[model samples]
Target: MPLNEDLPRGDAEYLSQSCFQFHEVPGSKSVTARALFLAAAARGTTVLRMPLVSDDSLGFAEGLAALGYRLEREPDRWTVEGRVRGPAAEEASVFCRDGATTARFLPVLAAAGRGVFRFDASAQMRRRPLGPLTRALRDLGVTLVHQEREDHHPLTVHADGIKGGHVTLDAGLSSQFLTALLLVGPLSEQGLTITVTDLVSAPYVDITVAMMERFGVRVQRDGNTFTVPAQPYTATDYTIEPDASTASYFLAAAALTGHRVTVPGLGSGSLQGDLRFAQVLARMGAHVALAEDHVTVTGAPGGRLAGITVNMRDISDTVPTLAAIAPFADGPVRIEDVYNTRIKECDRLEACAENLRALGVPVHIGRDWIEIHPSRPRPAHIACHDDHRIAMAFSITALRTPGITLDNPGCVKKTFPGFHRALNDLRTIWHRDQ
Candidate 1:
């Protein structure tokens, strides 16, 4: 299992749905991964309720288990007996399997403990840059050896423990680099002070800091500088929120089909940055209602949508979701300031343009922007490029436009495994109503 390995394609079954009641999405993958790491590093048993059972999440939990942490799996929840310390194995091997969070964060977690650890991932993760975070860890006095490429994965770390001190991170490439540093900071012997330069996706850092606080650690933030006190994670019972990124697909479905769709259990109060996607839809003329426990979206009756010009740097994960609906907008939809998207699971900007163009939509791709002009989307087989977000986002287009088959629908298993089944259920309800 190396990065960029080919994956099998699956047919995306089209669902004819105009309206549907709220559907419960799975737990947040981001939150679930973070919580698992924290709980594993805590002092006692920690119960996590409603954790997502997806490839990426399960991969992370398995990686932790490989490092000698005890995890008891249940149907809907997980019980993890904390090691109360960083990984102590003499030599631990972790398989990231293209989960960038696991690949990035786990190394830092290992560096915070005593051991020699090696990390490798799927071919895709091997292509992603890990130099910045690796460099930052070295700056914090951890001996990191990149077993493969200089800044890429297949790396090994000889760790005594994190000697927490001041470090500066370049956040221009990916925000997860900053997040990985922050997550390991509290476990350092002297704590950690981080000065982030050229930060992108700042909201995601907010999530890391907030989750740290929930696990009984406070991150002091002043602009780009953060001070993390050396503290031990306390075990507790925690519940994960529904994934806002996964919910974006259904919300876009409501907008694309001129129907109402609701995703329950996540709304305005969510810590996930993708929740801002609902606001983007609202700005694009979809009727978006955010209650305390749920969020709903209703499309215009005639498939009319407003084109908007906005910078999506902080909420770049939803770029594909927005691109899916961009062709039907009243004017050109300009999404800018998302250069980081070029390095995601796929080069999202290029993938969006290529797929939309395949359907005869007028699209202009730039270094950091995509502008989609209103046009009819013809049926085309969308090449998902083995990227989960690309597959899920294009499924939104397939809802209204027929013959739009996703080449790698199985890729959604990385995050939302039951996507097609949930989608088909919508079809069942919508047809019965008809």
Candidate 2:
């Protein structure tokens, strides 16, 4: 498929005919990119198996190439030769196209170099906030000049050696800020100690720590204080896990439609924090069975759904999936503690509520929380707003009701490039062009 191809809506009924199955969903692109960068910074040969072969991962690889890392790609493995402490290509400009992980993590990667590197991206990536990361970098002695907005992307980062010291970061907006700093802290000449105030999405930080350990770095945490030891990342073979966030859609399908669905490659011992989504489904009256390597979700009998009120700060990525199935529940579903949704690919809270309202679902949106009330089913076409989560979430709503159409379904390529195909593997329904 071309980069800009439109993903047409196939018949929903056709989807249900085939059970969605994959031997292994590619490794976590987020983890792979971070690990690859760490390997590149360690000046050794790192062999990565099952690395995420998506645009985001590709962007990170490109950034590493620009930074002087030699990468050799095979059929299913990658070998990266790290440059350790060296200057990147003088004229290298990293074009991170709408990949926030690359855009955020690359700044810390570039902070250890001596040359100036320009970072630009697609319009959507430019709109995402880089203020927290930029501020943290500046505090560590990295000179960054904004080519446009003070807090946005398209900036020039002139590296002047990192003077790592104690710094306070506000993670109320996104956890990526803290993750960026944590990934690069050990490589700094002086090591790093960080204090976080009002941190949100702490689980993601835990992920960063776990990945850092996999690459041979130890991060000590005492309450709000994080200490990064001065050690090089070890070159080792690592595999990324299936994305728990992407699995939420299939899990939601089973909950809403009374279908039994099992998403393979994710297990009870998975690393992704979003795997807790099965517990949410269980709370909503779905029967959940967990085995060693798979989770099976069956909808409540007679469609007798229970309402839920929960705090989703840790698993905010599953919000869209949960919100899409909210109307099917017996009563109101209230989700709170996700204020960071406003700064994601889109303002998810408002976009979700507005898109639900467009389909005649009663939704009350607050600053950081949303309450959705179940009502009689009314079908309508939904605008995806070029947000992949919105597109996937609304499509789940169409499974039970008719007249639900999605505009610009192609937005799902941002994460699950085969989202529509996987969706088609679960259900059969009508799809009409508007």
Candidate 3:
């Protein structure tokens, strides 16, 4: 199953399937971005091992360099020279490609120092709102001026340093809002205390705090309020776990194809909320093994999976993956409480529904939920909407149904660059075994 020989065209239908023993996935984009922020604010050089090197993570690393932070990037490790005082450049312009972490986290990072920094992202990212995070920064006495849109990107931070204090935030839109403020907390004059009225993806905040502790900062959480001391981070060599969200594709693939796929480095001890996607598969009648350091998903015999109604607000990133597989389930798959998907990269709920409909699957769309009816999927070209999750998730459909294509398959560079190649390799192995 050589990519060029087996596939008819670029981003065409996939012609592979198999039960691979294991796969090595890239590092977590969420962890890598947070580590980059923390390392830049630490007291010593930070060595990040196996950090994700995709567009999003690289954009974050590049944003740091644009702000005058020293970084030495290699194949396996990246070393960032910490500067407690923030950006070395007095004036810098950063283009945050298509990464929400880069767009959301970098401006506040610049505010913790003395510099004039301008931040902008791709047109696609510019449409996402950051009003909550921006408003919180202003409340903390930081001068932030959005060049084009308020609470949106193409913004400038007239950095005179953040004298951080207690602030109330609404993290319902994203947890990165809270994590950004948290990463810069230790650098604040009075430290930082955040009282959150609402928060989504709470587990990501856990990852932020746990990673912060490893960098020598303790984040104290008393219910909804999180407190961080004004202490410099002690940079150390950190190892990033495999991205759980990215692993969702493989696990879901196993559950869909009656194959067994094991992903190393993400298990009971991992801090990603998306790891719960395996449990979602379990509820859908897949056999799942969650060891301390690895997770394996084996499909039910004959790939006969039961449909399930699950609320996916916490692990909403994998909603597209589930949506792609729902048509094959024993019953209609109803995924609820995932309104946040509408705001990511594209209106993911609508995108998933539209693509499902294209494949002759009946889909009902609500304000915060999508119900996908069970049916035999027809061959169709999927419109990816330039969202990486949309492309990667729908590619799973091509495994069983031929003629599936992606309008923008390259959009996966936002996280996993070699997604298609990796999936193809798995298919080749499965074919060989058969």
Candidate 4:
């Protein structure tokens, strides 16, 4: 459906070309979410530089405002004055608007404040499981009421502030659950000692801990047990790095087209686990270079890359990007340990297999793995399933293979609003003959 006063546009945008391009991608959505929440909890004022302006980040900023926190926004920076004690409102409703981070993290934040918060989500967000986080909150003495369904969204929290002692969290479903609890732990009277079981995507926990330290809160960790001391978060000016997950698409484009692409401000020094995606591309025969301030990927010789078998547990977000490039590989590409992909924005594993099949590629789907066998791809309409990753990942395939069209093109606005324009910029080349 088109916007009001805008007619439905015809024809699909086809991606093409081989050229060298350098682009600074948007701020990491993961980093932006953590920074926003930490800033809202910190004592005094905190400023975030180059924060992402996407639907997810904006949704978080707006939800905080609804809870009576003042966030002053500039074109590229955000200034938030922390209400040291917590949210000013005693009763508030936070609408996550399809941001899983917001849905998971806000409840815990509310529990630490002086209010009862009603958490609401989009139709898609409502379908996600919140048992681990919500149950853990209840055990910590926060009163949680599932307004609609148990372990699902549209829940209400009667927060008298969390006691936050010893608690165990089932981390199998989403790491954000652990991250949400960990973020609010330092504010508790007893602090928080959390023991995590069945923890997947463990690297994300490291990211949360690292960011907490940046805000003047130190989290003690030994094996699966984490202890956050009862301390106030000190406000600090922070600069967010470019999103490595978003950088993966352009890197994949270079791998597919035998060209060079560089994404500035994302490199080996970055805290994002998704930065390891460049390593996967390197294993697939792309020339990956990591500099102090940027990372670059040059296509394999003769525009052919070798397929690989990889365990994507630490970097599952790039599974779609790898799946898009798998068809062009010389052999089969098997992505393993990605069972969590199913519970994301959509059934990502099946969505990747379905879209690949639509493009005339043979794919084998397992309970936790996907194997893409090399086959000639034909033109097909790719269904994005409202997942931003699926939509962006397939755009890389469309560059070399002309017939790919995304069904829900507007879905890219969830993360990268300028994706199509950025993909088109690959056509700007300076030939030697000139």
The Cα error of candidate 4 at residue 340, in Å, is 0.2
What's the C-alpha lDDT at position 191 in model 4? 94
Report lDDT per candidate.
0.85, 0.77, 0.89, 0.86
> Which regions of candidate 3 are displaced past 4 Å?
1-19
Error of 2 at 344 (Å): 0.7
lDDT of 2 at 192: 89
How much is the lDDT of residue 103 in candidate 4? 91
The lDDT, on a scale of 0 to 1, for candidate 4 is: 0.86
- Could you report the Cα RMSD, in angstroms, for every candidate shown? 7.1, 7.1, 7.0, 8.1
Task: Pick the lDDT winner.
Answer: 3
Give the Cα-based TM-score of candidate 2 against the true structure.
Answer: 0.90
Model 1 C-alpha lDDT per residue in residues 1-434, reported as the tens digit of each score = 01011211111221112246555589998889888988987878899999999999999999988888889999888999876568756679999997999999898888877878999999988998998898988888899898868999899989898888899989889988988888777788898999988888887888888888888899998988989988888899999999988998888887777777767777556788888887788788877766556667777787578989989998999999999989989899999999999998889999999999999999998999999999989999999999999999998888778899988899999999899898777756656765
Error of 4 at 111 (Å): 0.8
**Candidate 3, position 389, lDDT:** 96
Candidate 4 least-lDDT 10 residues: 1-10
Expressed as tens digits, the lDDT of each residue in 1-434 for candidate 3 is 01122111211111112246555588999999998998999999999999999999999999999999999999979999999888899999999999999999999999988978999999999999999999999999999899988889999999988887899999998988999999999999989999999998888898899989999999999999999999999989999889999999988888888877878788677888788888888888887766666777778887787999999998999999999999999898999998888899999999999999999999999999999999989999899989999999999988889899899999999999999999998877766776
Off by over 4 Å in 2: 1-26, 428-434
TM-score of decoy 1: 0.94
TM-scores of the candidates are 0.94, 0.90, 0.95, 0.94
